[model samples]
Each structure stands twice: as structure tokens, then as C-alpha cells.
Target chain A: MVMDTKQPFEKLVELHGATVLRVCRAVVGPGEADDVWQETFLSALRAYPELPADANHEAWLVTIAHRRSLDSVRAAGRRAMPVGEMPDGRSPLGNPGPDGDGVWDQVARLPDKQRRVIAYRYLADLPFADIAGILGGTPAAARRSAADGLKKLRTLMAETPPQGGTP
Target chain B: MTSTDRTSRTGPVDLAFAPHLTAIEPGALHRLRSALAETATREGVLDIAYRIVDSPVGQLLLAATDRGLVRVAYEREDHDAVLQQLAERLSPRILEAPARLGSAAAQLDEYFAGRRRGFDVPLDLSLSAGFRRTVIQHLEGIPFGVTESYTEVARAVGNPKAVRAVGTACATNPLPVVVPCHRVLRSDGSLGGYIGGLEAKSALLALEAAP
Candidate 1:
């Protein structure tokens, strides 16, 4: 019956892990998302003691995730290996309509800034300002990138209209 | 509009991946935590490792210091509060990584399933000291399916007059089941106060006595 407050970082993983993993997968693709996810938490654990106690934890995690995902991309670049194959419309894991258009592939193919903005804003539900903070730009710039990314995604989906429910 | 709210007007740019976004393999987080614990241990910074395990009574909060399994608590103990106690009495650098408690968890599993008679996990007794520490240590020798009177436990530890203190020790045993504190009974052979409630004490005794 002893009362206490838990400051363990474990709660953070239970809370924001899905969002962070989603951002990683959306930004870097599933092939590398798990590694980026690992790196993000590892970095968070190392620096957790130094983080401001009142800091917005979700934003802090996204910030770490953004930086870690970029590190993974940069490391991949140094190796110059071809990225993994995009999900074909027929992925067993993907909910495909009559014509599965590989929506994940389309998201991956967007311009880098647009992909980052969309993932930061939508997947992680971070504010444009926080996304700006992580990706280094003004809030307006992040918003514009998200809008542009959505415009392109809407156009692409118009042609095929990603049918069927979630996989 | 808030920057996050404005994104909603952008026609669900994340819609295409919403399903995937909502789901992450539980294993992914587990693996990440395992790796994190490993790196922190290798770097000599991991102070406490813990995981939740279901027992005959209910979900238990099993925590370990770098030294050994330090705390095992029942759900009624308020896992969050127990974690907080662990953070305070132990260290703030605590994490929930089941891999670190695999052996202890397995031993508990076997105990609940009625296949194991004893726990093999190393224990960190830093949480208890003085008479409480002595009483808790004596509890480990009580043996499975056997009950010892609190007065007897106090006597075993050279403090026969500290019967009430022995009862208090059994009530506050941080590593209750693993330390076999439930095996300690009142002088009248009745269940005494259990941090997890008398019902839990009865349940544990019943589980151990099961054929």
C-alpha cells in the first residue's frame, strides 16, 4: 500500500512508441524503421537525465526520432546501398483495392521535405512549430510542406482511390 | 490554428498509412527496450530492470537492481506506485525490459504453474534492513507449501520478542512470493496481514498446496 510516483522512462515508450515508430517508418521506410526506432530510444535514454523536466515529452521524442532517422539516412548514404523494394500493391500485409497502387511507395517517393513534413505533422501529431524545430525551418514552411505533400497524395489516390480497409 | 490542428485541413496526408501507423509489432518495442537495457548495462548505467508478470494472484511488478531481483509486488500494490518506490529506494534509472528478468520471470511462471518449488534468482536486499532484513532473509528458508509462525521466524532470527516486527516484515516484504513471505503465518496458524491483502495470501497458499 506504499504510495510512489514512477519516473521511469519506460512509460514514455508505452506512451509515444507507436507514434515514434510510425514517424520512423514513414520517413525512412519500414525496412529501416526498427533500427531508427532503437537508435531514437537509446539516444533518449542517454540524454533523458539532461532533458528539461517540464519539456513536452512527445515533442522531445519526435525531435530525437527526427535526428536519429536522419542519422540512419546519412549512414545509408555513405554506404550507397539501394533502398529496399517498395511495397507492391499486392503486399500480403497491405489492404489492396481492386488495383493496389502501393500508397506507401508513393509516400516514400515524395520529395524529401514533403515526406518529412507529412510524417512529422501527421504520423507523430507534432505541431508544425515543433516539426520546424526538429527539421529546422519556420512553422509556415513545415505547414506548406505538409499541404504540398497532401496535395500530391490526394492526386495520386484520386487515380486509384486506395480501396479496401486497413491491412 | 495550432500547427498540429492545421495539418488536419490538409486532407489527411497521413491517411494512406493510418492503419500501419496505428499498429507496431509489440516485439519491436520489446526488442528496442532489450537493446537499450543491454547498451546501458554495457556502459555501466543500467541501475534497475523490471517487467510485469502474471502470477497465481494477479499481475506482479518484478524489479531488479544491478545486484539482483530486488522487488516483487502484486497488482494491489499499485504497480505505478511500486515503480515509484523502486525509483526512490533504488535508482531513478529504471526501465521495463523483460529480457533482463527472463530467468526470474520464468521461475515465477514455473512456480505459478506448480512445476517449480524454489526460485533461483539472485536477490538484492537493499530495500530491507535491520530486523526487517533479517526477517525477510529468514523467510527464504521457509520452504514451499510450508507455513511458519511469525513468532517462529522472529525466533529463528534471534528476536523471539519481535513477533510483531516479524509480522510487519512479512507485510512489507518487497520480494513477497520470491522471498516466500507468504509462508509466514500468525502464531495461531491464521493468515496475517499481507500487503496484497489477506485474500492474495490465501490464494498463494492455496496455489502452493495444490496437487
Candidate 2:
């Protein structure tokens, strides 16, 4: 019965790991999502013991994920020296839009705050308060960002023809 | 699925694109687990990496902390139960991934194969404390192929009259075969009860006694 003790950390990973992955991917694009996700959980595991038992587990993990995403972006910015010709801004999602994972491409085109609020609110299903807690704003601002982000995403989706379609 | 967990406010947002969002990140979890282990070992925070090896006696459970080998268990001790005990005693942040146990396992392999007499690997004896810890430490000094009585072990630990307490310590020896608790026998030159059962005690002694 001792083994049946609080394994909340492993359970935390099992529950929200995928959503955290998507949140990071949405924020920083796929090329860096893996590192950021790993960092987020590693930090979570390190601090897990001291965490309050009554805390919101999802918000806590996403908060960690949010910080790690910024760290990866900063690190990549420093290491991003000039290389060969840059790819077209069109391929920002780092994959072919025709693959029908174009949601990522559209999500990639969104402004940073809108992208994160959408990922946290819709994709990860965090409430506006948790999203605001993670991204730092009032809950009303979180809700506004979600609405604005969704409105822009709809416009983009409507006007942009599918990449492989006859035009 | 929607009735209980994962319930969320869809609000007024269109969600036709939710599938791509919820689609699992391929191989991301595996990468994260590996990263966790690597960073934990590197950072020395709640690291609980372990490995298992078949011995001349039985399959042994080998676990290491950030410092060194922390535990060794016999097959009869139930390796799963042993791991859980470790999880309880230490942290549940354990993985059976065998990351930092290479040297310890190889030394144990050599000891079993009769190539080495004394262990050269570091030990994490945090599991033992106070009198029991001191008794076990004295047991480690008894040498390979040599035997000591529990009274002598008690005396070696500067507690000559604590014989029964010494037996209690040996009975609860967390590292067992690796720490050589089996080398402590009855003062009348007889095998006493071993945490690993008497036969394992005899096997270890016999294995060491072979010339």
C-alpha cells in the first residue's frame, strides 16, 4: 500500500503532457517544442515535492511550460546566427500546409499573445483565469485575447485557400 | 469522455481546428522522460535511477542516488516491492532506466564472478541511520570469504552488549548482499536468519569461500 502513495507528478505528466506540448508548439513552433516541453516537466518534477496539495495542477504545469517556452525562444535567438538563405515566411509552421495540419500554420501566423491565449484557452482547455495567471493579465483580458485570436484565425482560415486546392 | 474530466468552455470560438491541436506530439513523451532522467541525474535532485542484474544467488535489485549505489536486494525480497520501498523511503521520482549504475553493476558482476573481493564503488547509505547504520558499516569491514559473529559485529561497532539490536540491524540491512550482512552469523558458528533467506546466505558465503 505504500506504493499507492501520492504519485501526483507522474500522473501530472500522464494527464497534461500532450496539451503542454501543443501549447509550447503553438507558442514557439515545432522546431523547439521538444526541448521546451522537456524543460517544463523537468522543472515541475524538481519542484513537485514542495508544491501545495490543493494547487491547480494544470495551471501550475502550463505556467512552467510558459516560462520554458520563453527560455527556449531566448536561447534560440542568441544562437540564431546568420546562415544560408532563410526559407520563405510562408513556411513559418516548419511543415507543408497541405499536410492538413495547417492549423499549426495558421496558429503560427497569429500574433504572440493571441497564439498563446488560443493554445491555452482552446487547445489546453485552461480557464481564462489560469491562462491569465500563466500569461499575466486579468481574466477579462484573457477572454478578450481568446476572442480576438479566434476571430483572426477564422478570417485567416476563410480567406486563405487550402494550399493544394485549384485556385 | 466529455462528462467528467477534460470538460472545457468552448465559448463562442469555432473549434473545427481542435483536432490538429489535440493530436499527440509524436515521440514527445519519450523524449521528455529521457530528458527528465538526464537532468535529474545531472542536477542531483530526487534522482532515483536503477538497474537489475542476475546474480549467482538470484536476480538483484540495484539502485543508485546522485551520490552512489543506495540499495541491493535479493529476488526473494520482491524487486517490485523493493523499488516501491525505495520510492516511499526516498522519492517516487524513480525510473528503472539504469542511467548511473554502470560501475556499481559491473563491480557486483565482478564480485559474483570471483574476480573481485572488495567493492570499489561509492555507496549512498542514507537509508541507514544511527545504530543500525553503524552496525552495517562494521559489517562491510568483515571482508570477503570471512565471517563474523553478531556479537563481534556489535563489538566492532563499539556496542558489545547490543547483540540483539545488531541482529535487528542485520535483519533490516537495506543493501544486504552488497553490504555483506550475511557475513554476520551466530556466535556459536551457525547461520542465523537472513533477510534473503538462509540458502542465499550460504550461497554467498560459499561463493566467496571458493578457492
Candidate 3:
């Protein structure tokens, strides 16, 4: 399986690297997400020989990414820790402020599944079907999970009073 | 604190973070490509060099390393910014040498000339990881002229709910032309935001869509 000639795979990296990273970040947190992403691609490279020539490569890669993210979460024992700094080098947990309106902090407080789903669906903007495939559920189920998570977030946002309110 | 004082405090807090969200600049784009080439050449690892080419809409900067073409940039962005970004995000040593990027530049020239449809160049995407890499990989599948919805891209990547994050990736695309970030659009068929500006996006789309 001399698959070293697959130039399209390189193109695939240029095109979808950001998308993959976003999903990994959402699921595994930003710090540990890169390791998972690298592993996913490394696996993809190893399995490239076996992939059907005409198969949807993007779909295949995503499936691998989903599994890797889940594995990363499990391996970390769901510690609810923040990933490392963002690409801009900003801290993931966010710098605390006087009124405590740091968006990252609010995001961190979310339940693990909900937080991952929100980052995946909203922040990453992946389709429900793809998310479901990664999460090991039907598309509808994925959508429901995302919706439920969003509802919880809305509630959190609502409950937090605006700083320096009249009341 | 008084109610008015509280309101005033919150306002500045929000504003303080706003500056960090500034858009990419053109000068930074030029500097980045130059720096990347220089560093790569200095290390003797850059087999290819990059040159800044002018297109109808904006400047196009390309990078070629020993492995292949490593990056592309839009005219409106700062080359230094892009280079610094790559250095900070990926590595510290990027060099400048047009010969290293000659092959990529040739292909890109053909693309601009309407003689070529797709790119065949070596890439070094070591700058990003995780969801960002996923998004960039997906962008590669978009054909030269055809476009896909952000949602479709998300679905393709196996996380159908990540549309917003997908958009962010597009906005944050480090290698614009090479990755073809402009090809991704809104699900509703509208042109989406581009770090290079809407006009430049429109121009690229038009070039691809042309017969």
C-alpha cells in the first residue's frame, strides 16, 4: 500500500485543517485537542491505503476525528480542565474580570457534554449528522443534544444579571 | 458602586476586548510571507521561495519550502502579520526565497490566467491543529469553481452542528488562497465574510465561476 502519492490528501489538509481543529477543540478542549487532531490525521495516513478510492474522504476523516475526540475525553477522565491558549495565545479559561462576565468562564462551567456539543455545533458549525456520527448517535439525536445544550446556555446567560443594572 | 458606575464599568470591559478582534491587515500579509521565506531560506530547509504577485483584486503572496508550497496570502493582509502568525502558531524559522515557491507561483499564475483549475503543490500545514485543521482540510475538497455551504462543510467533517465554529475557522484561515477558504459560503447561498474582504472573495469566486 504505497499511498505516498496521494496529493489530494495534502489538499484536504489545507482545506479542512481549521474545521477539524475546531471540532477537536470543542470536544477535547483547545490544549489537548491538537494532539487528538494529529493522531487522527496520522491514523488517516496509515489507513489511506484501505480507504475506497471514490469514498467521501471528508466524511471518512471526520469519523476518525470524532472517535479520537471521544477517546481523548475518556482518557482525560472528563476533568473539565481548560485547553491551553488559543491560536492567538489567549488563555482558554479567560482572564477574570470585576463582574465575572468572561465568556470563556461561562463556557467552562457548562456540563462536559453540553459544552462540547455547543462548541462543536455553534462554535465549529458542524452538521448534526456529522456530529452524531462522531458522538455515536443518529443525526436527530445529535441535533437534540445541541439544542438542549443551547437551551441550557441561554438560561445561563439569562440568569446572569447585567453588570451595573438599575435593579 | 452606584448603578451608573456599574454600567460604566461594564462598557469599558467589553470595549477592552474589542481591540483584540481587529481584522487582518494587508501590510502584515506582505511582511509575513517575506519573513517566512527568509527564515526558511536561512535554515537551508526552504527549497522553494515565494514572491508577491499582484492580481486584479489584491496582492497574492505565496511560500514554497523544500517539501512544497507552504502558504498563500491575500493582498489586504499584512505579510509580517502572516509570517509572525505562522512563526508564533507553528515555528520560529520561516525564510524568504522565490525559487522555493516557484512551482506554486506557476500554478497560481495559471489559475489566475484561467488555464488551470486545481492546485497540485506540496503543503506544510504544521501551523494549526484540532478543529482548525479539520476545517482547512474540508476546504480542500471544494472544487475550483463550485462552492459549499458552511453547514455542508460542517456535515462533511462529521460534526453537523458546528456551523458557527466552521465560520470562525474560515475567518481565521491562515493560508487563504492555497486552502480556498473563499469557496465556502452560507447555507442560504449568500457570500460569507472573508478575512480579505467581501470584494476579494467575490473576485476569486468570479474567477473560478468563469468559463
For model 1 the interface RMSD, in Å, equals: 5.4
Q: Identify the leading candidate in terms of lDDT.
A: 1
Q: What is the lDDT of residue B36 in candidate 1?
A: 73
Residue lDDT tens for model 3, B46-130: 3334567776767777765456656677767877566555544443333445666667778878888899888888777765579
- For model 3, what is the alpha-carbon lDDT of residue A122? 51
lDDT score for candidate 2 against the true structure: 0.75
Residues A1-167, candidate 2: write the lDDT tens digits: 22244453455666777667767777777777777888888888888767765677778888898888877755665577544433323323333222655566776777778878887887677888888888888999988988888888788777774343321
lDDT tens digits, residue span A127-165, model 3: 677667666668887777667766765565467743433
The sequence of per-residue lDDT tens digits that candidate 1 reaches over residues B104-191 is: 9998888888899999988999999998998887888888899988888888999889988888888889898899888888888888
- Please provide TM-scores, in order, for all candidate models, with all chains considered together: 0.77, 0.69, 0.44
TM-score of 3: 0.44
Best candidate according to TM-score: 1
- lDDT of all predictions: 0.76, 0.75, 0.61
Question: On a 0 to 100 scale, what is the lDDT of residue A106 in model 2?
Answer: 70
- Chain A structural similarity (TM-score) per candidate? 0.80, 0.80, 0.66
- Candidate 1 lDDT for residue B138: 83
* Cα lDDT of model 1 by residue, A1-167, tens digit: 63434477777776777678777887777778778888888778777766665678889998888888777776775566544643222222222212343666556556777877888777777788888888887999989988987888667656654444544
